[model samples]
Target: MPEQFIAEESRSIGHAGRRELIAWAFYDFANSGYTTVVQTTLFNTYFVGVVAGGVGGVSPGLATLLWSLSVGFANFVVMFSAPVIGAIADIKACKKRFLLWSSIGCIVSTALLAQVGPGDYKLGMVLVTVSVIMFAYGENLIAAFLPELVPEEQMGRLSGYGWGLGYVGGLLTLLLCLGYLHWAMQQGMGEAEAVPVTLLITAVTFALTAAPTFIWLRERARPLPEVSGERILAASFGRLRHTFREARRFRDLIRFLMTLAVYQSGVSTVIVLAAVYAQQVMGFDTQSLIVLIMVINVTAAVGALICGHLQDRIGSVPTLAITLAIWIAALLAAYFAEERSQMWIVGNMIGIAMGASQAVGRALVSKFSPAERAGEFLGLWGLVNRLSVIVGPLSYGLINYWSGGNHRLSLLSTLAFFALGLLLLSKVDEARGRAAANNFLACGDS
Candidate 1:
């Protein structure tokens, strides 16, 4: 491998190291094309209006519910498999291979989503599910590589930058789709035809953006000192068992994870539900939702950068607690916002807090996990991260289903997660918690 491709953690950040961070950040740019174009705005519109035939005619609401549930289930599968895959990379010395395959899966799955069309509800759902499953799995595995690339202190900054890049990426893709839509209209194409083509472009963007990650990023997968005659599956199970057994050594890490699971669920559900709430319950038109999302993304970029720097300075747990408090307030405000403009204001506020909460949370995890098993640990983190979505959105789905499709109560119920997470997070001691995490890794290696 070329020297430029190798991601040496010691040399990954600083004035000289910014390029590496940029490369890392670029991954978000590529992935967000799929997120924004397919997951959030364009595809959801297409799925409902075209595939499901809108409300009272197959209802886009049903498709959205299935999409969320499918993503959650796919992550569950990846969680069960991650430790084994991660353990093999650790033992067989194939970290890059795993990352490569995972990225390819994301690219292929997303691009394939372009193939399903109108009147193909079942097929479209299957394609969307498979694509998101691949994307979720890839995201979990790719996250593990970040710790291997950057220095400990700067992890927060890079994580923020990655999310910032994601916003920028999403913006660019949205712009491209807008251009395509305009062109299609000029050429006398109906809205349906224009949308399918735009969806295809979204998938293409994922493939193009992901190319560099495969070509540029490199991992050394430092060799483990302990030798094992055991096969990969046995070794994975053994390490997983040990991780649980030794977790008692780091009681604070356990507390932190539990706290994060609860609060972050609130955060995750809000992000997932906001667009839907805006379109459905809030009664915002398509153009209004687009504008609001752009505003949110821009503000979110600023939020992530500022909050991330503060996290590095003040402390992760404290920063997170503050952000969660703000989130609780934001959700409450959203629940009551009567005017459309007021809802938009609430979204902008969410953007501000959203970046900080998510970026810092990931940075804190990177700060704790052993660099070698970062992938496996992150996989577990992804498990809880995804499980929250399953529980939060599914409950919301049930509410929506039960209330004769009333979305307001379902949207408001997410607040319970924030309140619960706040209580649990307060129990965590930051300094002692991180130290315990390090000690666990030391004992494992010993």
Candidate 2:
């Protein structure tokens, strides 16, 4: 009778836990619409092909350059601001408030994109830049909540679930956009008219879906004592500097970050170049490329779920190492693929590795971070990720230019980053890193 009672209580607890996780995961679902429809698939092409060419009087090549510059500028802004914002939020115990504001900013900016039409290229650029910066802030803020929501052991699985759900969201959003485009075409709507409608739909989807996260997720971190503006700035910078100065004590954590930066460069490069590679090398048409991406989204979700479970059973770092190995293998396969059928296999492999590596990386960082400093550290994580955005693509582009547009050689160059990351990753001791973070917290408290 006692055993039965205990089992019932455990089941009840599990049910409640699942509810919280779902609410948390839904934010990923909400924002993914923006990523898929606005950032990835439709808006950029619309902006370049229609707005820039038709209205702005720019050549396609120059329009592409302008778009790239806008994105790079936005990333630069976020890279500098994220850590400071995160530190302030931690001090104020206001992560949720910041997240809400950023999310709203992104939603409004995206919705306003419906106003941009042919020859409104400047407006389009401004809106995209602002929306992207806000999205980055929201991403950092939401990640700060991970340590609060679950224990270290469960972090990997929960992170995986969130990422997996995010991909599902992306898939659904893409399908919605595709359906809308098809319908709009039948109704005799041109690309310019139809694209703006898709942006509005994305904005609405993001705003509505993110509501659950705002409603259900609690801010558990306590605020530090209130400070003057000068003191806050001083303290934020001081703490950031101290983190770097104390890197030796947290050697494993620092090592892991270094490794992550290297591997992520390759990952970012692959993401930016994959469609181009398929279109150029494998001769995939527009519809075929879209289908390929859709399949990858599905495979990515599955990979995240599988790796999330594996992380708990083995360890986060080990899981990450395995994923990186798969990535290297996938890249090699992609470089060598001569036929469309072979490229499909490589695409799925890329999906699996991309999902697993990303999920594990986030969870590992959370595990190594003190609960009180999760935001600040995750902010640093964002910084490294943003920096990689510059390094990866630039390297790939340089190699391509040097080789006179030899894309296969350019693709193979990414292997160097991955290999270097894997080597650095081997030196990290996850348990020691967690211990170091705990020790720092204890000393600070004392």
Candidate 3:
């Protein structure tokens, strides 16, 4: 009887762990529909080409600027609010609640996009901006759960698992959108009508897939001291300030984040500009660009899985350095590619490097952050990630503008960001950073 009871207990633990991991990964799967369909593939173009023009009848350039401003404004909101919200979640032990509300906000806003049509550009912009803000917050909240689910040793692989799964989700969602678009066109529906349906599909997919995460993932962290409305605000800011001070004590973490900021800027720029470069320089059509993205998605998933294992064996810093080296090479390839086929090769290389760099970077930050304050620290991580969205594209655009739209020369500027990031990253002491986090937590507790 005793032996049977022990066996049952062990089995239950294993089952729960597996369930939790799947639930966590599903959030990534769920969100990728939004990322791939709305942000990446269809809706941005739909807005610029159809809604922006029909409604306000704005110039193409102004419409493009408005779209950019909406995205930038969303990032700005998240940039300022994420840390405070994270601190509040940490203090209140309500990360899951925050995640739930944000996910719902995103879903509702995205579903409402189905209502946007010709002459509804302003409405579309508002919905997209709100959805982006909610999505960004959900991303930050979900990532804070990583350290809780797995130990430091297993974090790299698990983070990789989540990311690889995410790419798969993105790929699948993109394929679904493509199929829908094709069918809609066959039925004599134009993009304006078809695009809204895709938005609905994305909303449904996100809500359904994210259900498991809300059900299975348990909140393990304990709440800090209870506080009321004004005190909550005061305490959250105070905690954020203290986090900055504590982070200074952990210099390596600070250095690593700085390095991440630099390299990620280049990475973000490459992703944002890749299709544009391919279309303008290589003269690839929409179909070819879609095929290229699909291929990249597959390679990215493979790279994430492979590099996750590499990170466990070689350590995050080294694995990341290797990935950065790949980025440098990929950028150089892009700069010099005179033929479309060569650009295709560069895209594949970028895929591999992109997946590995992102996965390893997140795991490295998790390994270095204080266990108790993971939310606040990862919030700061979100901040840097958002800031990179601004700096990277701006820098690339400036270079392109100055050089009379010389994209090849603009690509070279990305190389500079990667090279500087690599140089700064080499200086980070991963062990020392991990130790500093542990030591600070211990001293505070004592």
Candidate 4:
């Protein structure tokens, strides 16, 4: 919307038209507030500390588990629905439309979260679930645009651009909310009053910031004529079944998705629980938590930009493998972190690994997806990711609960996922996956 923002993506990094690319990245800017504030930073702590804090004799450990369950339940719904809706979007050529609606759903749901307060954990959980489901769908639909915007080799850079800009956006939004929170507290209001205002800020910023995306991000997909006069719902299912039947042709993609599902669990765990960990274990208050995340956002953006370039030069599999290794190291540091200084270092490491891993993974998936089948294939990607979200966060919660609130033990368990993912990454053949997608593009399997 602003010239300064437009100039931000004009550095000629991503190999795409600057305007469209900037607009696409703006969507990332728009949605980052939802994840950064509502999921990762503020409301999670609110849900755990304020919303679920000591009410009805709910233990802190149980509250943490409940938060994890809320996230898991949301992903569980998306796991089954993502592919079907994505297939429908593909057949109808409405990825952008789907993206818009999901954003609106998330914005509205987030605004409604202001209605939640202390002892309203049930309502808070439901609203968050609705918001997250919308956010996940929007994430999938926006990512499906990747292969259309650039060639496979450039996908990493494009994905990185969006994620890098996204962190900047998240940082800015957090700062804005932080300023308000600080002012409110100075004026004698506490979290219960100030937190609702921050949610409103997030909703408004999400709306205004997202305007550029709908204004400039064009949908390049065309509706399939073969599906004419057919029920899109049935055709969507049929397409999914057909894709399943022909999975052999895309074995490399299958292999990579399997690898992604394993390691992304660690990513998911950190994303949903990082703020909780910082608060509960490291004793970060609200202001301190915001600052820590802001710092992490900076490193995450740098990691995305650097790793994006590396992926194009060396290859996606190796780059992703390297990031997963970083994740293991980060987790080990987090597990042993006793001092706040050590936790900050751990946070930065996690941020770097997160940016690199997520950007490369999305780009790799795009490299293996044909343009015509982008939505369906990326939908499958969404399915695998959301499924992993369920497994990672829920299991971590269970471990915490069963171990009598031993968060360190629960966090340490995530190391297994990154290790498993790194091992699985070696099984992926990047070159073969790209060729398979190219072949499918030329000779339509339909």
Each model's C-alpha lDDT?
0.72, 0.80, 0.81, 0.89
TM-score of 4: 0.96
Write one digit per residue (lDDT tens) for candidate 2, span 242-290. Answer: 7788778878878888888899988877765676567656887545766
**Candidate 1 lowest-lDDT run of ten:** 1-10
How many pairs of residues in model 4 come into backbone collision? 0
Compute each candidate's TM-score over C-alphas: 0.90, 0.89, 0.90, 0.96
> What are the per-residue Cα lDDT tens digits for candidate 3 across 327-399?
9999888888889999889988988998899889889888888878888889988888777766775666666
Candidate ordering by lDDT (highest first): 4, 3, 2, 1
Q: What RMSD does each model have against the real structure?
A: 3.7, 3.9, 4.2, 2.8
Clash pairs detected, candidate 1: none
Best by lDDT: 4
Among these predicted structures, which one has the highest TM-score? Answer: 4
Candidate 4 lDDT, 271-376, residue by residue in tens:
8888988888889999999999999889998899889889999999889988998999999989888899998899899889998998899999999998888999
lDDT of predicted model 2:
0.80
